[model samples]
Target: MKIVLASASLRRQELLKRIIQDFHIVVSNFSEDSIMYNNDPKDYVIKLSQGKAREVSERIDHEALIIGADTVVVLENKIMGKPKDEGDAFNMLKNLSGKWHKVYSGITLINTKDGKSISDYVCTKVKFSHISDEDIQKYINTGEPMDKAGAYGIQGLGGIFVEAINGCYYNVVGFPLNKISGMLKQMV
Candidate 1:
């Protein structure tokens, strides 16, 4: 059976690679801004992921297993997605400093052949150390947080600021390996 990924995120691609070495990437043409927020993080992410997978499924001319994922960082009920600019990144990092936040990753697996699919989400708690303004600037200068949700990546330089994590490390990285493994086991 053929496997396809319905996302353009390098992070998600890398995470998925750790599970299966062979797969094709089909960037979902789904417009993300079309999603409406309902204040439910898990539901929101699942919807977004499913939308991506569905979009890709419709575009593909052949049968394949398609995977879609979406991640967000939540702080005090506020959702922080990718930064709009360097200043936005700085503000997000500042808000995350010395705070415990939740990272939610929603994953959807679609079997286009029979239209069978499953969607789920994983949440991880991450705590950031008190970061100084100077350190934030230096980290921002590296341009790592620009494309990452919550203005930081636990797998990159942003890892240094993480003081504690209470759940799957990979979840903060944009995919939850343990949950995904179990979910895929039934599919294959």
Candidate 2:
């Protein structure tokens, strides 16, 4: 079976590589603005994932199983997305310092041949160390957090700020391999 990943994320592609070998990657052009303005983070990600999957599925019917995923960080009911600027990154790091936050990754799998769809979410709790303003600036200067959600990428140099994590490591990295594997196995 042909599989397609509808995301431009290199992290997602790397994670998925551990499970599937024969697949294609297509970056989805769906606007992310809608997700930021939505009230429910869960629904926001699910919708984003579904939208990406549908976009890819439309081009490859009866031959593709499209997978799409969206992840975001939330603390105290406030959803935090990627930092818009360096100052924003610093502010985000300051806010996340010495606090616990929830990282949610919503995944969508769509089988075009059978018209079957699955949507689910995985959440991880991450606690941060007492990151100083200087450290935040140095981290931001590294330019690793610019494209990552919550202004930090656990799989990169930003890992130093994470004191502990209470869920799937891959989930924090942007994809939940076990969940996606289980869900896809039944379908494939």
Candidate 3:
């Protein structure tokens, strides 16, 4: 069966390549803004993932395994998605400075043939080093954090701010490889 990824994120695409060498990309039309966060970060992400997968499944005609994923950075129970603008990005970085935050990734798989589906989540604890306002501004100037959760990308220029991490490193990169592997094993 063909495998389809329901995301346009380069980081997610790169990570998925490590496991599945020949999957197809079908960016989902599902809008993240349509989903409301009910104070439950895990559930919120799972819903978003499922929404993406279901939306993409409708666009495919043949048998395929569709994968959808969403990631968020949570600090003190507050879920942080991509910033709307540079100012929002700066605020997110300032709030994350010198703090331990949890990065949660939600994965959803849909089998177009049998309609079997699975949704799961993985969380990683990431601690950011103390960031000065000047440094945060400089990082913001790089324009790397604008499209990332918590206004930072652990795999890019934002890596310098990360002092330590616990749990799957791939989770911080927006895809949890081991968790997705296990989920695929159960599905197949």
Candidate 4:
């Protein structure tokens, strides 16, 4: 069977390579509006992932294993998505300093042939060390936090800010390899 990825994120692409190296990339045009859901984080993420996979599945011509994922950072029950600007990034970083937050990743797998699908969400608790304003500013200046949830990338320079994590590191990066692999096994 052919394999396809339904996301444009370089992080997801790179992480998925650890499992399937020959998959095709097909970005989904499903615009994510977290505000509309306002439900449980798990439900929100799963819906988003399924939406992406379904969107891509509709566009493909042949049977393929389509993978889609969505990730979000939650602080005090509020969902934090990609920052809008440098100021937004800075505020997010400031709020995250010296605190523990949750990272939720939802993965969905779709078989275009029979329309079979599986979706699950994983949550990771991450703690950030107290960082100075100057350091936050310096990190923000790199522009790394602009396009990342919670205004940080745990696998990049932002890793320095993380003091501890209670779950899969790959989940924080965007996808959960363990869950994805297990789901694929079930599909087979």
Candidate 5:
């Protein structure tokens, strides 16, 4: 069966490529703004992922396995998504300075042929070293944090701020390769 990825994120695409070499990209029309965070970060991401997968599945006419994913950075129970502006990015960076945060990624797989679906999540704990205001400004100037959750990207220039991670590195990168691979194996 054909495999379809329901995301437009480059990070997710690159990670998926490591496991499935020939999957197709079908960016979902689902909007994250439509989902309300009910104070449960894990369930919120799972719902977002499921929404993306279901949206894409409805748009496809052929049999395929649709993979949908949503990732968020949570610090002190607060969900931090992409920053809206430079100031927002600065504040997020400041809040994350010298602290441990949780990265939660939700994955959903839908089998178009049978209408069966699987949804799961992975959480990774990431610690950031204390960052100076000047450094945060420099990093924000690079524009890497604007499109990333918690105003940072572990795989990009923002990597300098990350001191360590206690879970899947891929999960912090927003794909969770091992989890995705295992999920695919179970579905197939």
Candidate 6:
């Protein structure tokens, strides 16, 4: 059996490498906008994850296990995806400063051979330290938050802004190793 990851995120790929290195990175060009945010955060992420996995699975053989994942930061029940631009990122960081938010990652794996599929969600509570306007501006200027949800990447320079987190740290980084390992054990 071969393992394939369906995402372009280096962070996720790196996380997966820490557990299982026998994998290939095949980014799924699935447009993330198709998933509606009106549904529960977990459900929405799962839908996106499934869609991504299916997108990649279509071109692979039955023995390939394609893994796809989607993450979102939920604040007050509102889902926040990757920021649109610098201004949007600034606002997102501002909103997250000194506040607690939930990070939800939906992971899905599909084995096209048997049409086997599994979808699960991992949640982490993260709290950010109060950030000054200047600090936020500096962080935004660096352009590190542009491609990250909630305008921050806990594994990057943005980690400086996070004061604490409750739950799997790897989930916020991009992949939940424990969750992924548990699922893989069952499938294998």
All predictions: root-mean-square deviation over Cα?
A: 0.9, 1.3, 0.9, 1.1, 0.6, 1.1
Structure candidate 6, residue pairs in collision: 62-113
Candidate 2, residue 66: lDDT: 89
Model 2, span 1-188: residue lDDT tens: 78999988988998999999878997887777755546677787788888888888887646788898999898786888899999888888999999999998889999888889999888899999999889999999999989888999999999999999999989999999998999898778
Clashing pairs in 2: none
For model 3 the TM-score comes to 0.97
Tell me the lDDT of model 5 at 140: 96
Query: Highest TM-score, which number?
Result: 5
* lDDT digits (tens) for residues 46-116 of candidate 1: 99999999999999999899988899999998899999999999999999999999999899999988889
| Candidate 1 residue runs with Cα over 4 Å from true position | none
After superposition, which runs of candidate 3 have C-alpha atoms over 4 Å from their true positions? none
Backbone clash numbers for all candidates listed:
0, 0, 0, 0, 0, 1
Error of 6 at 83 (Å): 1.3
What is the C-alpha lDDT profile of model 3 across 1-188, one tens digit per residue?
89999999998899999998999999999989899999898999999999999999998999999999999999999988889998999899999999999999999999999999999999999999999999999999999998888899888899999999999999999999999988888888
C-alpha TM-scores of all predictions? 0.97, 0.95, 0.97, 0.97, 0.99, 0.96
Estimate, for each residue in 1-188, the C-alpha lDDT of model 6 and write its tens digit: 89999998888888888889789989998888887787588898889999999999987655798999988999989988889998899899999999999999999999877899999999999999999989999999888999898989898899999999999999998789999999888777
Pairs clashing in candidate 3? none
* Model 5 CA deviation exceeding 4 Å by range: none
**Judged by lDDT, which candidate is best?**
5
C-alpha lDDT of all candidate models, in order: 0.92, 0.88, 0.94, 0.92, 0.96, 0.90
> Candidate 3: lDDT of 54?
99
